[model samples]
Target: MKKTSLAGACLLALSLMMGSGAALAKTPPDQLIIGMNMNNLLTLDPAAMTGNEVVGIVVNLYDSLVELDANQLTNVKPALAKSWDISPDGKVLTFHLRDNVRFHSGNPLTAEDVVWSMRRILHLNLAQASVWKSYGFSKKNIDQQVSAPDAYTVQITLPKANDPQLVIYSLAALGNLGVLDSKTVQRHERDKDWGNHWLTTNEAGSGPFILETWQAKDVLRMKRNPDYWRGEAKMNRVVLRHFQESQTLRLMIEKGDLDIASNMAISDINALRKDPQLTVDAVQRGTMYYVAMSMKEAHFANPKVREAVRYLIDYQGINKALMPGYGVLHQRPIKAGMPSTLPDPGYTFDLARAKKLLAEAGYPDGFDTTLRVLSDQPYLNIAIAVQSTLMQAGINAKIITGTGNQVYGAMRERKFDILVGRGGSGMEPHPHSSLRALVYNPDNSDAAKLTNFQGWRTGFYDKQLNEMIDSALLERDAQKQIADYQAIQIRYDQLIPAMIPISQMVDSVVVRNEVQAYQPHPSATTFLRDVWKVDEGDKG
Candidate 1:
């Protein structure tokens, strides 16, 4: 399974949702209004925000103890902690706190808060656990890994000191830990509604911005925090309005209403580039656009059938016609920058081979399969293209389109014969984070049958994957690590679960010159602390 990439720039515009049916307003002198696809804050509670919408808001509202650098990995820098140290044996991690850091409520941050917050996260083990579980940790459970020696120092006790995950915690930084004031969480938990408490809606982050209001599915507004440890935000306020329709957002940007339009539709992308008022930040995402086949069916169970389906897909044609230059065609499961034992052998367009495989698989005339797809133009085009290509090989595919949530739910439930979806390929540039969920259940938890999404209950593959991952954890030799990785990739190639050979990405941001410091990161937008509203002439 490819780790989903978040390489795309944020899309949508805020002004379109202001919906008073009025004309586009002039850019405010000091305010930056941005657009997003949707804004559903089920809970601001860190424990509950596993999905994108919540994470989007929480990433702004809360401060993770450590932040993975601008590239999503490679470096771990201080957020709450000024510095940290690892024991010689790699069993204990100690940190020194930044001086005078306080929660939004004016309570000084202490090490006690760190311990309590971690303890609570492990205790509940819901959404955050999902994120943490992908960190290649499987103890009997989550409780066994964490310990607090004192207020300022956290000691994590691993089952094995040799595990590679010890050194890789920074890679999971954005998702793993958010430093919460232990006092607030404890009080809220005592009220038995921590998930719905005021703290969840409000926040006490040590970051440069504080949450002012969140109009669910509509808008999220944040104001600069004056006492930020990093220094004050030059911008007075940041407004993120959720706009579902791309055309509406395009109009807003054209009217000079929004300072930043995150997701501009394909139809509007070219036209927006002509506008002198907006700047488009575009990059190929680390996301893969592929079809997920159902494992439950006999036809899907056979590798030949899966290969035949792959044959039916005109990867090149799809990229040129449907996706246009938006993304590359995905053939294997692992994308670049992610840790995979699989090698990039790539894919071939073999129409003859596809027909042979289909005939051999008892589909001499080609069989029909429903392709569940998102009701978007890109996916719809891919679905139609796939159907046409499969017919050339004597297979029939029908496209069933719906909303994103609907398609995702159907995929999770194994409800579709084949589903067209885009997955983030390289969340972290490291292989451990990408393969951990798909290969073995991490030592700290029980969800071991994670990666074999085909419901392959075979102990053989599971044992093999676990042994490969564990050996990689133990490997101190550089050459041996590479060898182990190669072995893992070979196994992954053999298994062919959600096979995606190449990664396709769509990463771009469109910002007005007034909103300054709009550099893009692999994970998400930079913190509001770095965002500033500039003069009209200095907008870029």
Candidate 2:
């Protein structure tokens, strides 16, 4: 037989065996396999997770009180909580839990479990603690803040008035506020560890899938939840195989061995769009890639120097050449596609303007500085572009390259002069969501150092900005609240904090022709429950 004929014969034989239940136990016919680069996965615990790779899995394994609509990014719908209400003062929120919802461990989910899960986040003080703290939640007052009046009723009382929609957004799945199986977790707790160590590699969620296995940097497997509250998944098993090189992913998908390619090179993605058998989708993500400067560096401390750096960015050049199919020019702290987002001021590349600003800041001769960047493609290329532009203004910037951890670690430690990084406070699709964490910093002391608050991390604080954030959240008038948020953006332009918005991320995912309803989240997390595959016969 010919090579192609022999391969076809073997595949037919395997399909026959799978139909006969001989191979069904190992690889089901309804399995959906995905390929991606998973080097960024650091932890499985939602409380400690900071990378998107882990969030992709966490969203599958856990349930949140509310979730973003799969088809519409801005709309919020009920998930575990069937209904909720807010008091007239906007300081109290009450959630009524859904009936008969059960966790993977077979324990019924309750209001007490929700309360415990939220308190656990505060006690651990993990990556998302700053989000809760921003709403005036603390370890000392957690009991008064979050309470379960009954088995199915959960109430949250905030210290100050806030936007109820913003609060609901914070409790959404993308926010990493997953409720846990408190009884099962307590059973496995060892010496007051709160099951933190066990949860690092285990599953305790109530979503459509259950964690089967996780091999660091190799593979993550999830089995369909037989008793899922949302009903059974169309696919029996979902497999995520890690591929460090995009070439391998391209070959596998081309050969019909992989169903989806989550991460691909820009060149390969552009080429894949031309293929008839593959479907490529590029969606706007709620993230921004920008440069952050540490105020501890005296040179960057000058407001004029910061403004000069903003003018130094060649946004149009970089987006056209380097960020094709990957990003678009977005020059605001609040990402586009959100309510109350300000229009771009159109700060184009002008070497003369940069030089003028430098001269006014008493640095006409320019000065030497260092810029830290991740030692990876796209970022490294962006840094190179920035280096070329700074040279025109006589600013000699030395590029220092390192891995994600090393570079972000330096930013977290306040050890870098200037760092190119990507982060956003737009997880909630609200202006306060980004403004409170990225630009507003009420306390600038070391004692209140919040790693999650990018503004606090870089020692950027403005009393007026902080007041504006608070006032906007508390304003009961809808139109006036939006106006206040718009005013905040104007003030942000005047105060050049640590960030200068460069581009908004545009994420692409390729899937085979058989896959349908594969909508990607704005946060880049995959939702597989709605995705289904059609056999060849079904297509005809």
Candidate 3:
């Protein structure tokens, strides 16, 4: 749809929902329209993108070596690499590339491109490079460790004793390591930044869709790649429009202007659950909604103060009341329901205990602090509730709300006192995923610049905890590894870490029943290539 049409349609949908409740309008069956807030999407460049909103879009525009099963996350399936094999000692991986595949730039996809992409990640040392560096890949050794033996074969030799499956899962799920056409990116490089500036809004990949245009915080449009290697997309085009107001997205979905609605309020989602025309999918994810405190502040630097803040949180109450469509009661550092996860530690909302702890920490009358949160729904509501509770304990918390860029950017720079956000790199099924994201801090110096690690962002560090997490990852014994993980959680609780997990995240997406073959991936990599819509009259 054109911009003029979409604007007119938005006004019509609002009038229909508010004025007369007439028969709903319909969108073109050959196109897919999604309503969501684009505030979190800063860049389309996969290597520099931060949030899940960008990940969902990048996966459709680029193809990685493999894809993890949406239902069974650990199950790896082939994509550009038709087949792969691991060495007997599990130190080397060999991937055989598919033949005749071409990037959107018309350049042939080869093992050399795959190797160059991996090398580019380390060479840049941006947000995406942290994971590869943690796995022992570095700018100094990437060219040697990642090699393309032939046009059709690529090999990655582990630089350290690491679990090779973890590496494969990162390759499949991160979305940042998607192979880029080296020649295309090289030509677009600006001042030797390796095309970081141009690829911010443009793409160079061999995925199922080709980006037509993107206007930040407004709309993004992409069309199907007719000559895609695997198959063409079912829809001719995909249109994503930004709807800042959740009610607007709900109204558009009800009027058939939006084929799907994402990031809506819990109340709106519940009201639509009764509508037989819509189906609400609540995909339970591994990420968690957390309350993080910066240890850089003298008050929070005291472990007793961190423990006091923990008691000030109404975990059970928040999950019961404010977190219906958002999350469930989850308290441990590791995500619950996994085989290795431990039970909740049973932290409750006790204002008296919080007051007592605060008094003992030398703040007899509590203290003042600023709490940072995104202006989006759920986060703002959660922060409000937390602020109220903090006041009850004589702690005055001033709420400051902003866009995702402002809120997360402040946390990344260690410039905030308190933060309420949802994130952790738990896309993989392994326990190490969450630990590496939420609690792993290898270096805590000002010059280390480990902004990607949340623990480092909060100035939370413990050498013992870091060692345990690392030792558990490389442990070859299954039962032993689980025990090690369980021990790590216990130690984290005892230390009163800077971040507190309140609830596990659940992403709810509302879709019209007429849409078929639309499956929301647990890892946010929802593919649109196989999705199609059926007309109401065709049901017979």
Candidate 4:
């Protein structure tokens, strides 16, 4: 046998890594290539965008008033806002803008842009408008609520008495509140849309990146804004290539073609964890994976039926079997690890009790129902497991699966009987954030069309619960506020909620070894400006 030279052995190893059908795609040193699914990305407009994928991209394209620290979530750092002050009444917040900031179009970023950006959300009444609307801001009151005091100052006077801190957190954490260049956006305005149509493809921000090109479901590329007020992004270019197949992402990351991969299957993620050059970053989120029942449904409308259905769920089996890389066993509306979050109620799979309750609700033989869930991984798995348990309790539930639009759209219309999904506003590190999203339905009327709130989507509304959430947010005493949140969780559970918390969300992202400072934020406002890369070829 002939002995190969050391360099020849290295070459042989490289060839083996790039297996058959794998392109020898080497990402540039000054470029960061990320592989993930972009199917949920419907729009580039911050005000219209949903999903975590859009959050990360939009934050880089536009700067928010403040930013939540990826490591210290409670710490709100100044971004476009240099400093801020809350009035003694807690109903007013004044933000001082950074004078040196300039949009990618070379237009100065000012208080006018900040106020206009916020007003536009209420004016358009799009996906992002719901939360602000719930805060009492509307097209009629927005101008009075949000005002540009001066060129350098923006003041937001609450339309209602609320926690100023939560409002600040909302501004910081939700990427939708990204400051837009009013002048640039106005130029593109047509049909009185406030540039919603134009901004779906274009951007007017003063962040570290400038949108270069975006092809739906294919590729999105952004070049570093060299004149960024925060300096410049470490990478010259960032490429987000869509990979619907987790296997493709696995292959690309293994071959050093992609620096980061998100939304990969749990099996693929576990397999990739074995690779020495890759690390899986599991970030815990405040959102939850829940089983929701629409109160509008006749069967689910009965409190006895709702309680029986809750008992029918196999929480332990689902969390242990299906929620390993995805989430942990969390059975409360508030996210796990928060000071105010309560422990799980220890509800187990008791078919006898479920049957008894079902009989009491006049469904002795059980009733047929439909379970709506996204066709994506872990969700469908959870639904299948749920379907099995529901069958055991004599409840015949047919699993209905579709794309995000199809399933969530049905939920939005309050037409879903049951839903297995993950949601709740975990963007802020506050208990009210999740409760407001999951439990507080201000209006039960169908005409409200508050699809952004999961509680509204499920036709779940409790007048007392809504008041509790509102009052708790306004409580200035720390201990009393915490008590209020704890009480809220207990009350939500006792009320036989339309939504049952199954597991908290844990997002896993696979990253190559050479990527540096790639912090995955819980809020999803993951700024890529600080992310740099060392040459992978420099490895010994």
Best by lDDT: 3
Candidate 4 residues lying further than 4 Å off, grouped into runs, are: 1-25, 447-449, 536-540
Evaluated against the true structure, the overall lDDT of model 2 is: 0.83
Could you give candidate 1's per-residue lDDT for residues 317-425 as a string of tens digits? 7776667446665554445554443544656668898989978888878887788888876778877877787778876778888997788767655567777777642
Clashes of 4: 0
C-alpha RMSD of candidate 2: 5.6
Residues 407-456, candidate 3: write the lDDT tens digits: 99999889999999998878878898899889999999978888878999
Local distance difference test values of all predictions, in order:
0.63, 0.83, 0.90, 0.90
Q: What is the TM-score of candidate 4?
A: 0.92
| Candidate 4: tens digits of C-alpha lDDT, residues 1-540 | 232354355455556866555567678999999998998888989889988999999999999999999998999999888899999888889999889999999999889999999999999888888778778899999988998879999999999888889888899888988999999999999999999999998889988999999999889999999999989889999999987667777877888889999999999999999999999999998889999999999999999999998999999988888899999998998887778888889998999999999999999999899999999878999999999989987888999999987998999899989999988887799998898888878888999887778888888888988899988998999999999999988888888999999999999999999999999999988989999988767866
Model 1 alpha-carbon drift over 4 Å, by segment: 1-24, 134-144, 159-172, 283-286, 324-326, 338-343, 437-463, 496-498, 538-540
Pick out the ten consecutive residues of candidate 4 with the lowest summed lDDT: 1-10
Candidate 3 C-alpha error for residue 159, in Å: 3.0
Question: How does residue 330 of candidate 1 score in lDDT?
Answer: 56
Q: In candidate 4, which residue pairs clash?
A: none
- For each candidate in turn, the TM-score is 0.84, 0.91, 0.91, 0.92
Worst 10 residues of 3 by lDDT: 16-25
**RMSD per model, one decimal:** 6.1, 5.6, 3.1, 5.6
Candidate number with greatest TM-score? 4
Between candidates 2 and 4, the lDDT winner: 4
